[model samples]
Target: MTTAKTPAAASPDTPQPHPRRWAGLAVLSASLLLVVMDMTVLNVALPQLSADLRPDSVQLLWMVDIYALVVSGLLVTASALADRFGRRLVLLLGFTVFGLASLAVLWANSPAEVIAVRAALGVGGAMIMPSTLSMIRHLFTDPRERATALGIWATMAAFGGALGPIVGGALLEAFSWHAAFLVNVPVMLLAIVAGLFLLPETRNPRPGRWDLPGTVLSIVGMVALVYAIKHFGKDGPTDPQTWVPALVAAVTLSWFARRNLRRPDPMLELRLFRGPAFTAGVVTALAVSIALAATMLLLTQWMQLVQGYGPLETGLRTLPEAVGAAIASPLAPALAHRIGARTVLAGGLALSGLGLLVIWSWPGTLDYWAVAIALGMVGVGLGSLAIASAVIMAGAPPEKSGSAAAIEETSYEIGGALGVAVLGSVAAAFYRTHLTSEELAAEGVTGRAAHVAQESIGGAMDLAHEMGGAGARLAAQAREAFTGSLEWTSVAGGLLMLAAALLVWRLTPKDLDLNEVEH
Candidate 1:
């Protein structure tokens, strides 16, 4: 049995520590920080962006979402390309592309233009995300040292996610939504300069012939599935718009899985799922992302609109999650040792569910103190999943580290895409249910104004500010409707996290031990 490896170094005596491995790790962590931060900064940027761009609900969702969907489509192919060509070369090129794309946001005046910028950034992100993990696997060869390095990597990720909204909020306070993206430019430039100096060139010497068909299938199937999910959520299950792409996705993904299973040098190495621990890790990644992404997307808007907070204030309110994750990340290994890995793994999700339940319990108020408690609980829960990386990487053969990284990254990306599409749609649905066209018409706000008001809280608020007493009443009603929607959405997410916790508990071996994870 193999243990999943993470970003770490190899046996110092055998591989002589790669001399600059620690410095290389710093570069990797910095690059990872930017990628992860970019994923989240948009949460705080969305409302202002919506106000300026005036995107309808669907276009707004696409602008907020398509980044992850694009990343998901490209991750596997990018990982393979990195392995075949050169990891260092691919990573540096990723930095360049990422920087230039962020810079392009200067001219992204229209909704479609912004979405295109995000998609281009996703291309750069896919190239960076997996290559860093692959490099870390090669860097860290020793188990004990690898464990320590993993902690640092996980902490960096948590910290980056924590910083994103805050950093974006601070920038948005002074400037427009473009600053959220523009911030990435200098960071990527620095990464490129530092990477060129500190990082070592590495690649899989035996990368087989490029699996063009598999690559096409994976990318198209993933994009189709995500599109279907968003449409299914928005249009319901009966719509041909929803079902047609879904059918295509089902067939293409099934065929893709079959091809990977049959080929000795498969594009994805589907056999990784054969490891129970790997399966659990992948599932955790998916479920946690679904829960977290939706929570962040909704809560940020709620804070700004309902709570009457500025972006900076809203960002600060989210800090507790990071604090909780930081505290829990260090304690998770010890907890796993005392009880069991399975217990810690399942407990994390359960705790996060409890967080959602905590807020759901007081749905009428949506109090900050209660929300803070929930945030902390979810953060602690997030910390436990760091073990997931160890379990996944340790389970794969050394030669297949690149595949393992790709799979792990793919899970995170797709999970994020699904989270936004499915859960965001749920919130939108409930909001529309509470505030229908009839309700808006009753307020004497009809036509394009009523359509805009009913579509989203951001749009409604903007419309309200323009009108008089009627608009004030409309705004109040919109806030209440959105409150109800958030309540329902959070409970739905809570139940899902709870169900996933139970599933993880059952699927992982009862006697699973963390000590077994040392590669």
Candidate 2:
């Protein structure tokens, strides 16, 4: 059983015993693992789910995007609730919800049911993430110790994200998509049991009552904004369905900001942005997320379509990237110490940009080893950014810790969605322009069928097989178009990363010791 020790009793100078510290690390890692695993686990399973459910486009989008949307929108509120209530209590409730939702997903036969369950899973994820970070904040009061703990935490998170596709591929081969959702059940249960036994209870001693209006406004604003972005990506900005929600979201968020300014106990204190380190960290998080998400989405398509790798093989090949990330994450803190956060962040971004450039310069002929090296560089850069950003956020005051963590997490979620939408659209546009008339004729795909196929890489693959000889030609052209698009996209990504490096170099402070800060 875990024993409650006062912060004074477990001072930074007088460290906790190795066993206790390691146990705490385990608890944090378990919570983070759940969060990271859920992020990408559904990707490989989406095809199977679509086949089983036969959802319409919108419903399918919801099935894929709702989890992230809900988690991103609710994170601030959930973190605040945890502070108001208790971290341990919130964690338990989250774990229970996640476990139950996993079961619901397994049992769900309808698209609507699956969407609802996925949304529930998002809520659980929102609750778990901030609490995990906050607990880490409390557990590792020493800067050196905290860095080590965070390294382990960051590695686990990266590993879990990479592991999702691999695990899903294995499950897909052996069983079905249902196995992917079901796998979470046993893991969640174990985490719950272990957390209850080993985790210490912590709470904000002076947390104010929950701000109902703030919560409502945040959720409504985020949902509206995300809906608008999704619609715009799918149908363009002039689409009434896209613009209306976006306009409404802007108005509501403005109102929310005004309301927060007036309230003494705001859900998220706007004052946190005054800190340059925190602000820089948030921007870095968002940019890194956009890069990672876009790269992964494109790389997966490239592997399966152009490279002709099966799902299992694609997953295995991607493991090198994860290994590189896992190795790099632990070195972040030391690098930061040697060169300062600003320098390290800038260098990391530059490395990422170079990696993307490598991909952009890749010849049409596929080279697995070269591709792997490029991807590994991208992973290393991201891993460094992830660890550094976490350290910045967790170093904030206890009262603001939850909100800070939420902001960082929100940046990632929104950035990821934006990346996919923007880069995916770019790819689609290229695919359309490059489609030869001969190719279309050969595939027996014309007009709407051809249009649909060009709109998405996945759709293209599906339509190609449906058509005959001509379809094969069309598919090859489409794949080549996608590769061309990826090359340009990578160039754009590299430029953005370089810009981020410059920004971080200018903005982040030097010699700031996170452990010395008061809650």
What local distance difference test score does each model get? 0.82, 0.75
Top-lDDT structure, candidate number: 1
Expressed as tens digits, the lDDT of each residue in 1-519 for candidate 1 is: 113333244434435445677788889988898888888898898878877998867787688668777887888888888888998999899999999999999999999999999999989998998888888777766654454455557666777787788888999999999999999999999999999998888888888888999999999988888778777766788899789989989998999999989988888878988888778878887888887777778888899999999989988999998888888876666677688778988999999888888877974577789889988988888887667676667677656777888998888877776776688788888898888889888888889888788778987888888886658888998999888777777888889999999988887887766554544
Candidate 2: minimum summed lDDT over ten consecutive residues — where? Answer: 1-10
lDDT of 2 by residue, 1-519 (tens): 123333444456554533466686797797688668777767767767777788877898898789878887888788888878888789888888988888886678899999999999998998888788777766665555666676677778777878777877788778877778888788888888888878877777777777788889898888787777667767788889889988989998898889877878777776677788878887787777777676776776687777887667777878877887887777877777676667767777888888888877876654677678787887788677655655566447766677777777788788887777776566656666777545665667778887667666667877877766646766777787887877777877778888888887777777655444344
**lDDT comparing candidate 1 with the true structure:** 0.82
Model 1: how far is 93 from its true place, Å? 1.6
Each prediction's RMSD over C-alphas, in Å, is 3.3, 3.1
**TM-score of candidate 2 against the unseen true structure:** 0.92
Q: Kindly provide the TM-score of model 1 when superposed on the true structure, using C-alpha atoms.
A: 0.93
Q: How accurate is candidate 2 locally (lDDT)?
A: 0.75
Predicted model with the maximum TM-score:
1
